[model samples]
Each structure stands twice: as structure tokens, then as C-alpha cells.
Target: MTGAKSDHVAAYIGLGSNLDGPRAHVTRALHELAALPLTYLAEHSSLYASAPVGPQDQPDFINAVACVFTRLSPLALLDQLQALEQRHRRVRQRHWGPRTLDLDLLLYANLEWQTPRLTLPHPAMRERAFVLIPLAEFAPQVTIAGKTSATLAKHHDGADLHRLLP
Candidate 1:
């Protein structure tokens, strides 16, 4: 989603995959994100292996976070993420079900706004170690409501998060 905006803001995106070669799906999604028009993949956290948050019968997921600089607004960025998911053959057959690729807009320039389509700072991010651990790796200092990711991660120590890649 290319636009006329010249200013770029920092945004954090959460990526996860549990189907069709999980690792390969995540890696390919990262490349696609970096190739987005007017967007730059500034940083990425190490991949982690985690149990599915829902539907325990599904395969485990490989997860990571990407910090990107982009000129696209929140909605446009969300559109691009959904488009990327569609390209990867994502299906909405079940809630939190296994997927080929899942892209979530975790945070957008620290902006706190929400619409029917998306939410800022990801409502469940703090409680999910799969998101916090990797996020704390590169963005330990990022805060939501004055709480740092490092602190949030510490709070979720009981979560089933295992580092799978450097």
C-alpha cells in the first residue's frame, strides 16, 4: 500500500506460522514484509517455538517480531498485512486455528487508537510470551501504559516460550 505520505513511523509486527512448513512460512513472510512498498524492515527478533494459544490439537507455532519503518497509516498497513496473509493462503475457518501465516500489527509508532479492523499495542501481547520474549529482545525499552516489554516478559515467565533461532 503505497501512498504520498513522506514521513515514516516505527511499527512492530508479530509473525507466526504453524502449517505448511512453519519455519519456511515465517521466513518467506519476513521477506515479503521487507519488500513492501515504502517500508523497511528495520529489525527482527529471533524466532521462538510456542504451543498454540488455542485449539491444542493443532501444531505448535514458530513466532517472531519485526520492527519496520513505514509511511503507510495504520489502516493501510493493516490492509497490506492482510493482503500478505491472503497471498500465503491464510484461512479464517476457525479462531486461533493453525495457519500458513499470521501477521499482526502489534504497535504502530506508539499510537493508541483502535477501530473495528485493528487495535494498537496488541491487546493480548503483554500476556503472550510468544510476543513478549522476542519483542523484549530488540525492543526492551518500548512501553505501553508505562510498562516495558522486559517487565511484561518477566510477568509471563510461565508461558511456554522457547527460543528456536538466533
Candidate 2:
């Protein structure tokens, strides 16, 4: 499905926040993602709570994934996502550290691409339950690295991940 029509392509973005009212941050980011130019917020997973992936002293994170239909090129999409992060005052104090907002371009119409700036199928998606489980909720049948989203999600432990009330 990498050869979708030129007008639009379906892409997935992973959203997460751990600083400054994370749930509100994620909710606002969802609205902003929908408002992006040439993009439609197709669907999203419920908010999920998970322990921090890096430093232990930080607060838990709120996470979710979104699927969108977009006419923008992959790099352009990346630029928009980065701009969104910056708008939320995202910081890079340390790798996997807490943030106000984090957006990851997980997939783009099944295309496999690599640049100094981005990677398709997200290099760490398969191994992260936070990404796979939420991704499977909207796109269970999608395949990545030879396994479907449902399959990957089903196999992950996700012991630290829990869905939040709507």
C-alpha cells in the first residue's frame, strides 16, 4: 500500500507527554494534529498511562497514537510534527526524558524510508508496547517488520501500560 494516490497518504503518529498536565497536553495535541494543513485526524487510541521509559524519578506518561490522512510529504509531515512539539515547549534535556509533548512519525503508507532526520515503521515500534498496543487499537491488521500490529501488540507484556478513563 505504499503506492497510495498522490493526493493523500495515511500516516500514524505516536503521541506522549509526561510533564505539565499530560492528559491535557495529549488532548490538545490531538486537536492540533487534526488541524494540520492537508491532514485529517482519522482516528486515535484512548489515553494510556505508563511508567517513564527512562529516568525513574519522572512522573508517569500519557500516551496515544493517531492515524491521519495527509497530502504532505513525509519530511513535511515530520516538520509539522516537530513544529507541534516545539509549540508545546518540548525539551531534550536527556534521551527518553519527560516532555510537554512528543510526536513520533510511526509509519507512512507502508513506505520504508530513512534519512538523517526520520525513519519509517519507527525503528523502535515493534519493541515498545506503548506504541504497538495503541497502534493496534486503530490499525490491528497493519504489518510492520513481518508482523501485524495486532500480532505485535498481543505478544508484548505492556505490564506498565494501562488505559485511562475517557
Candidate 3:
């Protein structure tokens, strides 16, 4: 399913930034993602300012989720995400460390698979309040692992997350 089209699968991307111009980086990341081939930006959640999830010493992160229509397979989409990270100079030097940008494939339509490089429904999405809150905004009816968006939101760790802008 490398280059095949699957009726323009609906995909969700989790975006975040904590290093250098966090808000601007997130905003630019959205535009860059919208510019990718075979991918259409469908909707976006309100940007939120959230406390750092891991290694809490870093700066707070600006987070949001985006819905997109893409003909690219999951792996291909992952490739694009990594490329975007590189463009933002994101370094995985430390786990959950501060970065210029972070783009995660939170969900990929009705598809699910786990590979060394990628995982569907994003392995820890449910545990991350930063992802859950924004995702619920744009995909309140979507379900994953038999869990509704509302349920996921309820299960979040009650982190500090608030919309910075609409």
C-alpha cells in the first residue's frame, strides 16, 4: 500500500511545538502539511497551550490536531511527518525533549496496524491530554479501540490544556 489510493483515507495529525517560536512553528507546520502531495487539509482544531507531557522541565507546548484526506499509505504519510520534523530541526536527542516542532500520526481513518516504524491510533494517544482534547474538537464522533472521543477525553490525565485561539 505504498503508493495506492484508498478513497482518500481520512487521517488525523497531532501537531506540537515547544522550542523557538512555538506558536509560529505549529502554524507553519499546518501550512506545510497542507502543501504535501495527495493530502488535503480538511479541518483543524483550536491551538492549545499545554504542559509538557514527558520530562516536564521543558517549555510548555502549543498543540493542535488536523484532519486530512490523503491517498498516501500510512507509512508514506509517516515519512512526510518525519520530513516535516526535520525541516523544523526537531531532534530526538532526548525523550520528550523540547523541539521546534512535533507532528504525530494520531489516527489513520479506519485502519490499524503496528510496525517498527509506525502504529495506528497512535499507541499513547489516549493517555495524552494534549492529543485527546484537540482531537475531540474535530472528531468527537470518531472511535478508536472501541473508545469514543468523549471517553478518551474523560480518561486523559487532566493536564493543563486550554485553547489559545480559535
lDDT of each: 0.89, 0.92, 0.88
Clashes of 2: 0
What local lDDT does model 2 show for residue 100? Answer: 100
lDDT of 3 by residue, 1-166 (tens): 2332557888999999999999999999999888988998888888999999879889999999998889899999999999999999998879889999999998898788999999998999988888888888877887889988778898776559988955
- Candidate with maximal lDDT: 2
What stretches of model 3 exceed 4 Å from their correct place? 1-6, 157-159
For residues 1-112, what per-residue lDDT tens digits would candidate 2 score against the true structure? Answer: 3434568889999999999999999999999999999998888999999998879989999999998889999999999999999999999999988899999999998899
Could you list the CA RMSD of all candidates, in the order they appear? 3.5, 2.3, 3.5
Tell me the number of clashing residue pairs for each predicted model: 0, 0, 0
Candidate 2 minimal-lDDT segment of 10 residues: 1-10
Where is the poorest 10-residue window by lDDT in model 1?
Answer: 1-10
* Model 1 per-residue lDDT tens digits across residues 1-166: 2331358888899999999899998988998999998788888898899999989999999999998889989999999999999999999889999999999999998799878989897888878889988999988988876898888888887458888744
Q: Give the TM-score comparing model 1 with the true structure, all chains together.
A: 0.93
Candidate 3 colliding pairs: none
**Candidate 2: where are CA atoms >4 Å away?**
1-6
